[model samples]
Target: MKVKRSLIAEIKNMILQSREQAIRAVDNTRVLMYWNIGKRIFEEEQAGKERADYGSFLIRSLSEALQPEFGSGFSVRQLERYRQFFRTFPIASALRTQFSWTHYKLLLSIDNEAKREYYILEAVKSNWTARQLERQINSQLYERLLLSNDKESVLAVARGEKVPSNATEIIKDPTVLEFLGLKQKPAYYERDLEAELISHLNDFLLELGHGFSFVARQRRIHLDGDEFFVDLVCYNRLLQSFVLFEIKTHKLTHQDLGQLQMYVNYYDRFEKQEFENPTIGVLLCADKNDAVVKISLPENNRSIVASKYQLYLPTEDQLLKELKSELDKLDDIN
Candidate 1:
């Protein structure tokens, strides 16, 4: 007799759970084994302190002996990494079971203690795969946040000690769109950019930062006899507000700022619930004049932001230049 669909699903779920648990158990065991090896090697090295430093010699000999007997993974470089891993995380109790040896290895390469800790905390909270962790590090997500936020606030958010209260806390300027594979030099229409963003919505959302969820594209609003469409509508659960995005293929103007302000007001008047905060409007433009933006918005404005978007990742030189420029602007204000 054929099994009932519900019963079949239950069996399959049980099998899947068992497989996942088995994989996790194996990974944890492997991590512990490597840690133990590292500890043993470190202890042995300490015992021979009177002799000239022979750490490299010791690891090379160990690799040759272990590889011939056991397997291919036991190379001198990997052994050195394992040794460094133990040194980095000396206390066994501090090792996270959620992280595999690969995760720790990648993290060990990071020289900054605060940044490493932040990545670990975020990786655990986000349940990121090893690949995701690597990608975030490569993208300099932490450094990008540092652009707009104080170091203390950035570290606090990473540690999950403080929740982000405003849109500025989460939004990134010069948002990277290299994933969309659009040419940098070609002149593109706003609709083309919007379409590409929608097509690669997942990457776009990841680039958009935390707490954003897609709501609508070309969201329509009617007023009297006129109709208007917002480029994109998203909600930020953390901020508890509607976030309206208006894409501009050219430099931002006073008129663009006014249009976004109108959208924010519309959402505040019509869409926002009593418990929800005010709507936020973001103008994602190719370029922006800070003077024009400051003059167009209200003195106490917290609801609208204009940020540039980039078709490619900025080079190290470009990032350094921009950071210096920002610092200079701060000095001028002070």
Candidate 2:
């Protein structure tokens, strides 16, 4: 006799879930074991602080003994990593079960405690994969936020203690678009860039910052018998607002800002619900003049923003230069 299909489906699902849970259990145990090892090693190292190379000697001796029995997972390199992990996060209770050793490996690389904490919060909150977390770290997401916001605000936002009031609080000024796979120094039209962004919508949304969801591409509107098309539309749930994006493959002009302002106004006036906040307009431009952008918008403007888009990830030298410039600007403001 044939069994009921639903019964078989249920059994299959149960088997899959059990397997997943078992895997998780083993991985969690491994993480705890490593933490214990690290804690012990750290205690020993601290006790021998007077010996200049005691820490190195301890790790090398431990690896030589452990690797032959338990495989290369306990190699010298990995032992050092485990020790560093314990040093980075001393509280065992604070370790998240959802994170694998790979996640800790990435987090261990971050030197700043606050920045590491921010990444940890975001990773757990977003349920980011190891690769996604690595990409965000490589993109300098934390440093970018520090450029615009105070450390307290950024941490508060990450920890759910405060709501973001400024668009710059969530939106990165110079958004990285290296995942779009567009060639650098190559001329591309707005439509071409739009197509690529849509093709890599996940990456685009990731770079777009938090709480954004895709709404439409080429959103159409009619105003007093005139037709207008917005390049892209998104909704930010955190802000409870519609986000209209206008793409420009050239340097931003006052006229471009004016066009984006009109789109934002239309959305606010017609599309946005009474409970929702005003629409936000952003220009994804290849280049922008900060002075022109400031003067083009009203002094109290919060709805319209201009953000430059980079085709490639900023090199270390480039990031240093950009960060230095932001610091100089802050000094001038003070």
Candidate 3:
């Protein structure tokens, strides 16, 4: 007798679920085992306080014995990592089952306690794989956020302790577009940059920070027989407003800022509802002069912002130097 298709589908689903659950159970067990191994090594070292200077010899001896019995994973270097892991995370109860041993291993490489904690929280919140976590750390997402906000606020947002109220809180300057796969040399046009960005819309949204969804491209506006086009239009759910992006391949000017301001005003007057907040306008350019931006916008400006965009990711040293420069400027102002 043949089984019904519905029953077969149900059986397949049950098998898939069971397999997933079993995999999760095995991974959790493996993490716990590593933690226990680290804890044991730590306790044994503590008991031999007088011979602590022989820690290397101790690890080597242990590795020899364990390797012969259980195989090659317990090398001397691996034992050293286990010992350091225990030192880094002393409380076993604090370990999160959601993350695998690889995640913890990657996080252990980060020296800053606060920064490491922030990455852990963000990784969980975003449901990022280990690779994603590594990329974010390498990209200095934490430091970039700190560029626009205080350290406390950035950490608070990552930990879900606070929510951002304005676009500036989440939006980053010098937005990275390395994922677009565009050539840096030969000089690309504004239309080419826009096309590349649209082609990689998902990456663009991710780089744009949270809560943004694409709405329109080259959005057209008509006024008294005159027609104009905005490069990109998006909506920010958290801010409850439309966001207009004007891309420029060259340095930003007063004219660019003025055009964006006009677009923002147009959306605020016509497209926005009474319940929605004011529309935000972002001028994405290859370069921007702070003095020009300040002179173009009103002293109390909050809606329009000018930000530079990079076709490639800056090196770690480059980003750190820029960060230090910004901090020094803030200090001088204070």
Candidate 4:
């Protein structure tokens, strides 16, 4: 009787596992079907000699014909998107199984091929949901990468050929805090900002970029009868190091860097494991003194970074100016 019961249980488990596998296979097939459909529609539309006029009429006619028979999926806009879908991704094998048709729609909206490719690779590699992919693309992930890394390195990383080494590699400076629901140009204290960040910690971490895991906030350490408090402590799994943060509402000073360095030294000596890299420190200030920052750190310094933070996302004009300045510097080096 016992032997028979065990056999029944095993059989039921096998059946359940088989059912899940079947479901996944069907889902994958559905994705392939859509890709093929998009490809067919695109080719037909292109063969229309009038091009623009034919393309518009094709979508409108297809929507009218298919909507009644095929139902809600074939709207005029969706038909147009399908035409674009075929145009953008002529190769069906490259369509990611994890993403839905909605994901491809967002990618299609990106005008630049290079930028679209970057977002697609990142979204697939990260296993981001459609909404997350849309948000990151809309948030200008490619633009941020261009600002932070050299063009070659940025392309390499986007193509998944290279992995980022440090926080600065992935994290954007002047982090856009508008998503935190904080007032723009409101009278707020540093402590108030800290409180709001803690309240919206998950959003802050996303804005901080990949690999950051929260450790402690307002962490205190005791040494030789003196106590020091670091504003935020985080661990970057990719970098394999502890990231110490010191937040200042005002302009950064050399002393702020010194204080952060002390925290990093303490973490390196006592807190971090032998296998991990030395701790890194970040000075998150409302303003920064570039001359002081250049003089305060050694030329080869890798473990400390200082970045300014803004209450709001910068305008396109500001972003363009910053980009031009950075490009100028790179040109000078070359």
User: Which candidate leads the pack in TM-score?
Assistant: 2
**lDDT (Cα, 0-100) at 133 in candidate 1:** 80
lDDT of 3: 0.85
Better by TM-score, candidate 4 or 3: 3
Query: Can you give the lDDT of residue 245 in candidate 4?
Result: 79
Candidate 4: tens digits of C-alpha lDDT, residues 222-267: 9999998889999988788898878888889999888898999999
lDDT of 2 by residue, 230-311 (tens): 9999999999898889999999999999999999888888899999988999998989999999999999999988888898
Point out where model 2 deviates above 4 Å. Answer: 1-12
lDDT of 1 by residue, 219-301 (tens): 99999999999999999987899999999999999999999998899999999999999999999999999899999988988
Candidate 3 lDDT by residue in tens digits, 1-334: 9989999999999999999899888988987887789888888877887885777778888999998888877999888888888888888888887887889889999999988988888888777778777767766777777777788887887777887677677778768888887778756788989998999998788777667899999999998899999999999887888989999888999999989988998899989999999999999988999899999899988898787888777787877887898899899999
**For each predicted model, how many residue pairs clash, with residues at least 3 apart or on different chains?**
0, 0, 0, 0
How does each model score on lDDT? Answer: 0.86, 0.89, 0.85, 0.79
| Residue 244, candidate 2: alpha-carbon lDDT | 89
Model 1 stretches astray by more than 4 angstroms? 50-52
Q: Clashing residue pairs, candidate 4?
A: none
The candidate with the higher lDDT, 1 or 2, is 2
| Alpha-carbon RMSD of each model | 2.1, 1.8, 2.6, 4.5
Q: Which segments of model 3 are wrong by more than 4 Å?
A: 1-18, 68-72
The 10-residue segment with the lowest total lDDT in model 3: 132-141
